[model samples]
Every structure is written in structure tokens, then in C-alpha cells.
Target chain A: MVREIYQAVADGILVGGVYALMAVGLTLIFGVLDIINIAQGVLVVLGGYLSYSLSTRAHIDLFAGLLITIPAMFALGVVVHWAFIRRLRGAERTSMTLLVTYAVALIVEGVLYKIYGANNVQLSAPYTTASLHVAGFYLPWIYVYGFLLAVALVAAVYLLLYRSRFGRSVRATMANETAARLVGIDTGRVGALTFGIGVAVTAAGGMVFGATNAFNANSGYDLISRLLAIVILGGLGSIAGALAASVFMITLESVVTIWYPTWAIAVFYAALVGVLVIRPRGFFGRKEVRAQ
Target chain B: MIGERGAKAGGLVLLVAAAVAFPLAFPDPAVTNYGVFAMIFVTAASAWNVFSGYSGYISLGHAVFFGSGAYAMGIAARDWNITGAAVFELLPLCAAVGAAIAVPFGLIALRVRRHTFIVITIAIFFIFQLMAFNFSFTGGSAGLSSPFLTWQESVYDTRFYYIALACAAGAVALSWLVRRSSFGLRLRAIRDDEDRASGLGVRAMRVKLSAFAASAGLTATIGAVWFYYVNQVQPQTGFDPLFDLTVVLMTFLGGYGTIAGPVLGALLVEPGTLWLNTQPQLAGASEIVLGVVFLVVVLFVPRGIIPTGGEWIRRLR
Candidate 1:
């Protein structure tokens, strides 16, 4: 029984890494732009589809495909900002962005449905099915690699936000766009790039997510809710918090799955509500969020 | 542009007359079905707009209340052995259930600001959706079906149409009354600036919660009628995620916060969607079109039609 529990924790932690990858971009966008991108979930799924296309059609390795997909997603993110997000102004900026992003989600989803049809597709690499025996626990190679990548990306994002000059600018923009603009920072360019980078990371997440799960165009609906839950639980603007909350929540769900498999999903959301009620700013919310 | 109060009254009379005459004039099952659905959305959009639009808390999870109302109707019918038209009596029960869910849901979700409120609403929504699917009494995945209605087949759509129409009227009237009331002013104040509103002693949480409950109850009543009209209750249809999106789009299309905006949005968008859905070639393209339409409306007419048009009228005059 203890072994089984350990396996669930291992599984949860591994899967949590993929969730962090999906959620970090969402948090980053919120942190910098002060607008929630409803399209983040769909964008992650879009990332998966891109990777799938690359791996299947071009015979590219799954990890190697991210090189192409990330830049492509980044460009698309910039365009999304320019066309849809840029025009939102006035008192309803935050709320209007919600509508605009939802519209963007719909468009992307529609385009995806038009291209992919209704069938579910999964990414395949030899590593996807292989398991590594480590410390009496069998961890899938894909998940293990995914966990490593998640940590690396989270750390890289932290560095980019805190340890660099551009990071300083992004943080300044986040702190106060008007002040940042007064300081001669091209806040618009910063927003575009931040949004782009936020979306770009999802390429890696999507590749892993699509590899692990069967997904269709509509699969984004399911992912968005879970990603939103993770982002919220981690504190909206905190990437490290996202990573922490992801592992914690996923492990909790994984352990619960051991007994009441059917109830595991409900428990995931229930835990979020309970946590939020107790800590309205989430686990590591507000004070340590975003900037550092 | 409608400039005078008398002109507005005349327009309202003409519009209601047209709505009343719609199902009777058409009588086609499909056409009446469209009317029924349009009316359903009218009620739903109005219910949704009352809180989210007025209060500026954009919920992507209003479907929780919607689904709850649907399940309440279905469960109440089964547990009480009610059947036929008599099941209509469960409207209050469904409304109460919706309010019951909303209070706790509001208590938890509304504690946060607008953005977090949206996220938490979604979390609570997933909880309800999963419960409906997993719980044994909720009939699990197979879902519950309402008892068979004894109404004639030809008149079935018409009867549901009238029921939905009445509910839509009640909902719209409720919206009008609320907008004219101090509660609506307080909600708008909260929307405009929560800190200032609370500073002015509005009791922001209480006002928002009350509105949330009111909106949920209204939405639930409409959902119960819809469940009865459809004769079945599946998790997907009852707790539909898209339902929230569709209503939000409608409100945005017509104009958010304006009383007539959601109604106009529902009357237009619902029928258009139904027509698009019925199209053979465009069958898979409905969502795409809806998406495009949502983008167009938000980008070009973000303030929505009623407010924008009202501004246009003022400018021209």
C-alpha cells in the first residue's frame, strides 16, 4: 500500500510538471498584462497540435519540434495582442480583455476544429511509453523529462524576470505601466514580447501534454479549467507558486485516485475552493508574486 | 434612434406583439423550436447580465446555477413522482436550489476581486459538473429524463415556447426593476470601482452576493423550464460550459448592462445560431462563426449595440 502511494505521488509530481508548463505562461501574461487570457488553454492545445503535426509530418523528434513550435506560437501571440488585445482600453480593460481573449479562444478553437476534425490525437515518441525504474518507483521517461523541463523553464523564467534588464522592464511594466512608459520603456513592445514569451512556453507543455493524453480541438475546454485552477492556487502572478501548487494539487489528486478514482477530479477543484477560502490570495500569493 | 419615452413604449409594444405572434404565426415545429430556444436564451442572458454585466464580475461559470436548476427539476420530478405539466410547479424549488448553491458559491468566490472571482466561479463550476456526473443519485453519466408530457405533439413546441416566453418576460421585468433600484446602482458602483464603492459603505460583498443569488435563481428557473422542454437532463447539456459563453456573447452583442441589450442579443444571436446550426454545409462552422462574430462584436462594438446606438442617437440629435 505504501509502495502504491509512493507510485501515485511520483506520477502526480511528474504530471504536475506538465501542468506547470501549461500554467506558467498563463500566470506570466496575467502578471505583466493584468489581463487574463482565456485563450491560454486553447493556446496550449494549439501547441500540442503544432508539435503533433511536426512530429508526424516532418518526422521531427518531440523535443526538437519545440524549436519550431515555440517561435511560431510566439509570433501568433504577438499577433493576438496586436489585433485583439491591443485595442482594449478604459474602465473595462480587465473585463474586456476577458471577452476578447475568449473570442480569441473561440477563433483558435474553430480553426483547430476545421483543420483537425473531431478526432483525438496523441503525440508519440519511444520515450512516451518507456518507464524508468528509480528508487523503487517506475516513472515514465516522458514524465521524467517533462519534470526536468518544467523545472528548467520555471527557473529560466525566474531568471528572465528577476535577473535580467528586460526582466526589470517587464517587472516595471507590471508594477505600473504608466510609470514604465514615463521612464521611456516601450511598454507596448514589452507587452507584446511578454505575451509572446508567455505563449511560447506552452509549446513545450503542449508537446508533453499531447504525448501523454488523447486530445481533440475541444480538449482545451477541459485543460483550461485545470490550468486556471493551478494558476489561481499558485497565486496568479507567481510562476514558482504555479510549479509548487501544480505538484501539490496533482499529487493530492493522484493519491485520492488510489481510493476513489471517480472522485479524484472533484477533489482537485474542491481543494482549490478550500484553499482559496482559507487563503484568498492563494498559497504563496500577492507579496512574493511576479516581481521576484 | 428611439428618442422619446412614448416612442420607446410604442417600440416595446410592437416588439412584445411580434414576440407573441411569432410561434402562432409560424407553427412549424422547427420554427417554434427556434422561438423556444431564443426565448430561453433571452431569459438566460437577462439573468446573466443582472449580476455579471451590472457588477463587472465576468463569470465564465454561470452554468453551475444553470445546471443545478436543470438537475433540481429532473431530481424533484423523480423523487416526488410528479409528472406532466404539474412538474412546472418545481420552478420555485429549482430557484431555491440555485440560490442555495449561489450563496455559498458567492460567499467563497465573491470574496476575491473580479479576476479571481472569475477563476473561483470556474472552480466551483467544475465541482458541480463533476458531482452531477459522479454522484449516483444524479443518475451518473446516463443523466435523468423528465416524465413524459401528455401535451399534443403539434402543440408541444408552442407550449414550451409560451412557458419560456413568460419566464423571459419575468426575467426581463426583474432586470428592469433591479436596474431602477438602489441595488443596481450599488452593483454598478462596485463595477466601476470596488474600493471606492466599499469606501462609500456599499457593503460590496453583500450587494454582490445578493445579486449573484438573484441572478442564479432566475437562471435556474429558466434552466428547469428548459430541462422540461427538452425532456432530458445530461451533464453536458445541464451543466454546459458553452451555455455561459453563449449568454455572455449575447449580452455583449446587444450591449452589456443595458436592459434591452441582452434581450436584443438573445433575440438576434440565438435564432441566428439555430439557423446556422441547422445549415448542412455550415454545421461544423457554427462555432467558428460564433467565434468570429464574438471577435467582431468585441473589437468593434465592445460597449454593445444599445449603448452605442444610444450614443449615436444623442450625437445626431
Candidate 2:
């Protein structure tokens, strides 16, 4: 029984890493941009489709494909910011951005449906199913690689925030956009760049996700709901908090999933409400700086 | 300028008279169905506006109350072995159920800022959807059927059309009352500036909660009526993500807060949707159209049609 529980924990952590990678960009955008990109889930699916096309058509290795997909997604992100996010102004900016992003989501979903149809497709490679047997546990190679990449990218992002010059500008904008603008930060450029980077991370997360699961265009709604819950529980903008919350929530879910799958899904969402009821502001949310 | 009080009164009487004679003029079920759906959407969207539009908290999860109302009606009809017109009595239960859910949903979600409120609502909506799919009593994805009614097939659509029209009228009336009342003013104040509103002794949380509850209850009652007309309720049908988005779209497309805006939006969009969906070649095209309209409205006319168009009229005059 204990061994089975241990296996579930291991499985949970590995799966959680992939979710953390997907969630990182979402939280980062919210932190700096203050706009919840409702389209992130669909963007992740778009990334997966991009890699699917590359792998099947060009026969590129999935890992090697990120060299192209990540940059490609980043550019798409910039376009989105330039086109929609930049046009929004005044008190309705936050809500309008959400609506516009959702419109973008609908358009993307429609396009994906037109192109991909309703059939489910999964990413395939030798590593996708290959497992590493470690102490009575089977860890899939894709999960292992995805976990390592999540850790590295998270560290790199942390350093970017704490150690780099542009990082300071991003932080300044996050803290107070008007004050940051007053200091001649070119908050527009900062917002555009940060939004791009936030979306770019999804490409890598999408690659792993496509490998592990069979997905269609409609799959994004479920993914968005889960990702939003994780982001909130993780305190919106906190990177470390996102990582912790993803692992904790997914672990609880995986553990419960062993007994009753339906209940696990319920608990996953219930935890978000329960935690907020007690903490109100989430795990590591800002103490005094309320988002206006 | 056609803005005089007598002109407005004449227009109202003319509109009511036209609606009363609509089904009699065209008894075709297909045509009246368009009317039925349009009115149903009007009620939902207008009811939604009373809270989200006034409160300035954009929620993408009103479907939770909608679904709650549907299931309440479905389960009540089944458990009570109801088979006739008596099932209409269950509308009050649907309203109560909607309000009951809203209380807790508001308590937890409203504590957060506006942005987080959107997230909480979406999260809770998905949870309810999951429950409907898994719970044994909800028929476990097979869903529940409405108690069969024996009304003549020709007049069948008329029954639902009038019910929906009545519901839409009530919702619009409520919206008009709330907008004129201090309650609506307080909600708008919170929307503009929560801290300032509370500082002025508004009891922001209490005011927001009541509005949220009122909106939910009204939406749920309509949902119950919808279930009756549709004859079945599935998880996907009852708790639709698209339903939430579509309501927001209609509300935005017409005018966010004005009484006539959602009514006008529903009139235009619903009939067009029903017509377009019936076309065989237009598969999956309606969503793209919806998206384009949404984008156009948000980008060019974010203030929505009524407010912006009203400004244009004032300028011209």
C-alpha cells in the first residue's frame, strides 16, 4: 500500500512539472501585464499543433523542434500584444483584454477545428512511452525530460527577474505601471516583450502535453479551467508559488484519483475554493499591493 | 428627433401589440423557435447585466446558476413523477437554488479583486460541469428528460415563446428598476472605485452579493423554462462555456448596461444564429462570426452600441 502511494506521488510530481511549465507563462503575464490571457490554453494547443506539423512533416525531433516552436510562439505573442492588448485603454482595459483574448481564443479554436477537424491526435516518439524503472516506480522519459526542463526554465526565469537589467523594468511595471512609466521605462515595450516571453513558454509545455495526451481543439476549455485554478492557488504572479501549488494540487488529485477518479477532479477544484476561503488572497499573494 | 415622451410611449404599445400577434401571424414551429430562443437569451443576458454590467465585475461563469436551475427542475420533475403543466411550479425552486449557490460563490469569489473574481467563477463553473457528468442522480451523462407535455404540436412552440417572452419581460423590468434604484448606483460606484465606494459607507460586499444573487436567481428560472422547452438537459447543454461567452457577447454587442441593449442584441444575434446554423454549408462558421463580432465590438466600440450610439444621437441633435 505504501509502495503504491509512493508510486502515485512520483507520478503526480512528474505530471505536475508539465503543468508548472504551462502555468509559468500564465502567471508571469498576469504579474507584469495584469491581464489574464484567457487564450493561453488554446495557445498551448496551438503550440502542440505546430510541433505536430513539424514532427510529422519535417520529421524533427520534439526537443529539437522547440528551437523553432518557442521562437515562433513568442513572435505570435508579440503580434497579439501589438494588435489587441496595445489597443485597449482606460478602466475597461482589464476586462476588455479578457474579452478580446477570449475572442482570439474562439477564432483560434475555429481555425483549429477547420484545419484539424474533430479527431483526436497524440504526439508520438520512442521517448514518449519509454519508462525509467527507478526503485519499483516507472517514470516515463517524456515526463522526466519535461520535469528537468521545467526546473531549468523556472531557474532561468527567476534569474532573469533577479539578475538582469530588463527584469528590473518588468518588475517595476508589475509593481506600478504608472510609476514605471514616470521613470521612462517605455512600459509598452516592456509589456509587449514580457507578454511574448510568457506565451513562449507554452510551446515547450505544449510539446510535452501533446506527447502524454491525445488532444483536440475542444480540449483547451478543460485545460484553461485547470490552469487558471493552479495559477490562482499559486498566488497569481509568484513563480515559486506556482511550482509549489502545481505539485501539491496535482499530487492530491493523483492520490485521490487512485480510488475515485471523479472525486479527484472535484477535490482539485474544491481545493482552490477551500484555500481561498481560508487564505483569501492565495498562497503567496501580495500582502498590501492589491491589484486595481 | 423621435426622442419625445409620447413617441416612446407609442413605440412601447406598438411593440407589445406586435409581440402578442407574432405567433398567431406565423404559427410555424420553426419560425416561433427563433422567437423562443431569442427571448430566452434576452432574459439570461439582461439578468446577467443586472449584476456583472452594473457591478463592473465581469464573470465568465454565470452558467453555474443556469445549470443549477436546470438540474433543479429536472430532478424535481423526476422525483415527484410530474408529467404535465404542473412542472412550471418548480420555477421558484430553481430561483432559490440559484440564489443558494450564488451566496457561497459570491462570498468566496467577491472577496478577491475583479481579475481574480473572473478566475474563481470559471474554476467553479468547470467543477459544476464535472459534477454533472459524474453524479449518479444527474443520470451520469445520459442526462434527464423533461416531463412530457401534451400541448398540440402546432401551438407547442407558442407556449414556450410566451413563457420565454414573459420571463424576458420580467428580467428587463428588474434591470430597469435596479438601474434607477440606489442599489444600481451603489454597484456602479463599486465598479468605478471599490475603495472609494466602501469608504463612503456603501457596504460594498453586501451590495455586490445581493446583486449577484438576484442575477443568479433570475437566470436560473429562465434556465428551468429552457429545460422544459428543450426536453432534455446534458452536462454540455446545461453548463456551456459558450453560453457564458455568448451572453457576454450579446450584452456587449447591444449595450452593456442599458435595458434595450441586450434585448436588441438578442433580437439580432439569436435569429441570425438560428438561421445560420440551419444552413448546411455554414458548419463551424457561426463561432468565427461570433468571434469577429466580439473583436469588432471590443476594439472599435468598447462602450457598446447603446452608450456609443446614444452619444452619436446626442451629438447629431
Q: How much of the true A–B contact set does each candidate keep?
A: 0.70, 0.65
> Across residues B1-317, which tens digit of lDDT does each residue of candidate 1 receive?
45588898999999899989998789889889999999999999999999998998888788998889999999989999998889888899999999998898899988888778888888778788889899999999899998999999999999899999999999999899989999999999888888888889999899999999999999999999998888888888888888999999999999999899999999999999989988898868888888889989988998999999999998997
Q: Can you write out model 1's per-residue Cα lDDT over A156-248, one digit (the tens) per residue?
A: 888999999999999999888899999999999999999999889888888889988999999888888888899899998888888898999
**Candidate 2 C-alpha lDDT tens digits along A1-292:** 7887898899899889889988888989989988889999998899899899999999999989999999999999999999999999887888899999999989988898888998999898899989999977889999899888878877877889889999999999998889999999999999999899988988998888898889998888888888888988989888887888889988989998888887897899999999988886789876534335
What are the TM values for chain B, all candidates?
0.97, 0.97
Q: Rate the local accuracy (lDDT) of all candidates.
A: 0.89, 0.90
Docking class of predicted structure 1? medium
Q: After superposition, how far is residue B47 of candidate 2 from its true place, in Å?
A: 0.6
Recovery fraction of native interface contacts for candidate 2: 0.65
- In model 1, the Cα lDDT at residue A276 comes to 87
Instruction: In model 2, state the lDDT of residue B196.
Output: 89
lDDT of 2 by residue, B196-303 (tens): 899899999999999999999999999999999999999999999999999998998898878888888888888988888888888987888888889999999898
Candidate topping DockQ: 2
